[model samples]
Target chain A: MHEWALVDAVASAAETAAEQEKLKKVDAVVVVLGELQNVDRAAARRLFAELRKTKKKALHRARLEIRAEKAVFRCRACGKTFGLRDLNKLSHKESEAVHFLPEMAHVYTECPACASRDFEIARGRGIYVREIRGER
Target chain B: MTDPRVFSIGMRLSKVRRIIAVTGWKGGIGKSSIACALALALAKAGLKTGLLDADFTGASCHVILGARRSFPKEIEGLEPPLVAGVKFMSASFFSGGRAVALRGEEITQSLLEIFCVTQWRELDYLIIDLPPGISDASLDIIRLVPRAEMLVVTTPSVLAEETLRRSLKLFRAMRIPVAGTVMNMADRNGRAVGDKPLDRVPFDSGYEKTLGNPRALAASKLFKAVARLAAKLDAGMVRN
Candidate 1:
């Protein structure tokens, strides 16, 4: 999803949560995000801070939480689930061989068994509200 | 009324040379990449360059520069960290793995606070990677740095072109000179492939690549040409 669309989703989710909780104002918001989405966490927090302030509900103090998501990559041929951090260096080294991928999108790694540039990201593709706090 | 605080802050920021803004109305147009390329180019040309990633939702310069670990700190003022002799400040640095979505006066104040207290000791260039659209952050920086130059990034798509036209109006209003427009992701290499036109650069659209891939090698080469343009403009602020 585009960056702004994600922000809108988060804000809409927060409003829905607030309504469901029967709260007049939200005190804090917690976002759970996957690392692969290409979104900046810091910008989201600052934008949310300003967004909360200008709302009609009069939320005096509202904060946002950013939770990073780590993923596990499973080799399609070898059936090995390697932690992303362990495979990243090797993946970066092998990227030189496959120069056709766009600058923004990349092939993460090469399969050890098949030796093909194929791997599945088992985790790290969800962004949602993990928690929210309202005026008590 | 001209806010006295704004003036004080503007006075301080005026010290930095080559204030180039990377802006576009439509998103996903490689705004940050252009800023990174420009900043790196300025640095390579022996200038002290500072990069500011102003986009709250998609601050990618840190990732592109491979400096995702170092965060910006405030030692009396907001001091951006250095990478390859180029100083950079990004909303990503402040994000502790969260999002920063802001607009209007708050956005202006945050940018101003960064400009006011930065330990930017006599730099030659400051490249600002502005967010999408005509928000307060874009307005504030343009207003604050009236002499700064702008480089509008746009794709050949009609939506991006329309947006760029509107943004050009904003720059005109602020009296900021437009250095040029970058046609990012212009795939075909176009008519003057050998001559290398500044308006067009080819980019692969396939999804087979991963992070840190060097698909932009030609684009990186174009940075040298951009530096030539900067030098020709007499915007070379580097003392060395």
Candidate 2:
């Protein structure tokens, strides 16, 4: 599953942070999923749980926390600010494409006000590792 | 907050032995053609190879290789489909041949997503067809794939040669290893741009018709020239 790859990244990042901080055991990790990417939280949590067991000892017992951020786009040509819900509905194929590579949003979507493709993903564009807490 | 994708890129590429980025500073200089042909040549020589069309907005390797428009399978991650015995991945599969307009930051994000999610398992040579110029894709490739060696391509025109020299200087300043240069579409009597040794590929008038036909492309004069260059690269691998 694609989520497995993403979850693996989260685990890998947490492990690296734990090692750098000289943590003996990682207690929790917080991950944020941007709305534009639309990652499945349940799948990410499950995969992270499964992946932690195979990682280093510091990450073996790490708990995974998931969060979502609303997607916002600002047009460069017309100075229009909008959300994904304000744009035209995407086809199943287009949505799937954006799910894999969120940058595909620019290919399929345009600014609702001016119909311009030039826009900035002002917020909520990708998956990120928010925080990692551990015991030294 | 940190992007976790950056941390896993090295792990994803751990099994790949060599990464050769085919690049040129100018467009229409045959970077894609050379990259695709080089991949085919390496595969023909019985080496495990993968070709990644990193020119997200202007992806043409899929067209050159005649690869079908099929989504890569998701097994642990997206696995590049095998096309003509070479593992192939491109943004064309996602865009469905539509034009993708992206800013520099968006390009970097998409590139990171690709490097983080795609799995190229145990490849002997992974050829990256880069976009033209020292833009986001080229700069990010240098930042992301530290082990990648540049295979510069240029035409016989003085304009192309001037840009090639500038690119070479930039690469040297960055301390990037240039595997070699290829003088593509050169005249029979044309000399190498500089004192450095370079492989020359004479212009093949019939090369255009061979596009989208892997068999014909493999049998073309262009392919034969690239195959000779591939042999040199393979030999250099042994020396290294």
Candidate 3:
């Protein structure tokens, strides 16, 4: 749901040729995606597949690249930050596990400082276009 | 770069299904009606069909399908009802028409969740009846479903055509194939006057043609024709 803005960003950049003249021949567009956002990799590639069909000169040979960014979790009670892989050990999915703060079970995984369940999501951010390559 | 990692690690491997998003820039152009008719047609053709009413304002697919309430329980990844070979799902069944108050993003989220969490099993075609115009909700489906195709509906009126053209451009930009265009409210034999062809609409070429009052009967006939066209194309696409 939240990935549309990111999709729009990719489309907007490509439609306007934001950095076609930067440097070197371009053959692909690379995007960095966050685990927090549910970005469909196949859809992103398919969108570029359609985009390249028309702009054969530059994007014709270009492929859309997607790389995942790990999700970050934070504990509000003691300001703790941890990766989702670690949270999974505590029986929590990346997104759902973060919400289980000190409130639900204060003894489960307390804040290192005060051993509290209060927590908030931090670090693992949204999606963004990291690089664009084309014939310079 | 043909990244094998995307295919192996990142991409969600779901069944290959055709997603047909039926839309009309203007309301009351029989978008939902045509979608339902087409879904039923495909279902009868022995294709596993799923109809989704993306129109959050007026969820009428439920009424057309003769079903009520979005199925809360899934019978093994199949939440839609099995009626006459077609499976149906709609915001109407879930919200009871209360989805209108939801924000645009909320509607998109619900739409995605319906696709993600619902037990569609192995559907051959998923027909989505989108809300009016080229809004965020429409874009959400377009962006999410890489295989999503589009069908534009409009009345022959000039205003409707202009609006439908803008929508056509949107689909083109998204690279979604336009299956076909339908002109609703086409000239009918004077079915409105005296329940006979005698009350032919002025300038109507076919004076012998007589349609019925309330306009639905004539519109329904048009929908059936469009359904036949869709069925033909769908079958061909599958074969090829």
Candidate 4:
């Protein structure tokens, strides 16, 4: 149910593009889902599928494909970048905690170079529909 | 996201064998009457049946079912009141005749809460009367209950063909089985409605009148049509 918002966001974005292109028969909608978003995959797919019925002209024959973008973190103190793999380089408990607190990773682990607890998410924090395929 | 308790509670409840949503391509296509009639006819067949009035904003299933009043009770969870020999749930029970002043996330969450808390009795068939067109409520039901099948309802008007086709094609793309399409208010003498002609609803004033007066609904053409559709639904269930 919480994921309905995300599903609506994806559908709304696709409809916006479809309206701009004036495409009548969208073949598919491609969405980039951020891992940090932790959306329910099946629920999102069903929502997108149901939306296809209402947005008929905009998304005719539309299918949803959610490609998950992995989370990447950048150290604000040292300006270095890393991914979830780096988070796993910590103690087993700390690594597991990353799943729940990915945004606050700087609190548990220090920057490898500057040893500072200040960092910002550089990538994989965005969930957006990257492309929509119309009758082609 | 729903609370973990909601998921567990919903899982604990028994599963209905089949969930069919009767949806219209557009409003004023008699979606609710067909749904209510189908449910009644199915119930007449001695099957355990339930009808969910899912049109939160414009709920009228209770009216069609002639459920004059309901007693809200809580056992382990909310139990749907019985109406006309069928287990029934409707948003009208909660909001009365007044409009539900809800929008966006509130509507979606209300539906989710209903699905989570309502403890339905075991049913062989659970028919859902959906709001016209695809919407947040419809999508919530689709996403929440993956086993649901959709039945598209449309009139034989030339204006409705394109819209109906779009709906059917959408179910195809989404991998949802459309049992068949119901052409409402088709001419009694028409040869056929579509390729297979699952059922046809003739524009009968008696049937329309019966909607407000339940006792007036006595084996009319509409009744037989819905009964025939129920038989077809059984065949569809078996095929699946």
TM-score of 1: 0.54
RMSD in angstroms, all models? 14.6, 1.4, 13.6, 17.9
Worst 10 residues of 1 chain B by lDDT: B189-198
TM-score of chain A of 2: 0.97
All candidates' lDDT scores?
A: 0.59, 0.91, 0.55, 0.67
What's the CA error at residue A100 for candidate 4, in Å? 32
Please state the error at residue B49 of candidate 3 in Å.
Answer: 0.9
Q: Estimate each model's TM-score.
A: 0.54, 0.98, 0.52, 0.60
Q: Is the docking of candidate 2 incorrect, acceptable, medium or high quality?
A: high
Better of 2 and 4 by lDDT: 2
Q: How accurate is candidate 4 locally (lDDT)?
A: 0.67
Q: Is the docking of candidate 1 incorrect, acceptable, medium or high quality?
A: incorrect
Task: Give candidate 1's total backbone clashes.
Answer: 19
- Please report the TM-score between candidate 3 and the true structure: 0.52
The chain B TM-scores of all candidates, as shown, are 0.79, 0.97, 0.74, 0.90
Window of ten residues with lowest summed lDDT in model 1 chain A? A97-106
lDDT of 3 at B135: 83
Interface RMSD of each: 17.9, 0.6, 14.0, 16.3
**Poorest stretch of ten by lDDT in candidate 2 chain A:** A1-10
TM-score of model number 4 = 0.60
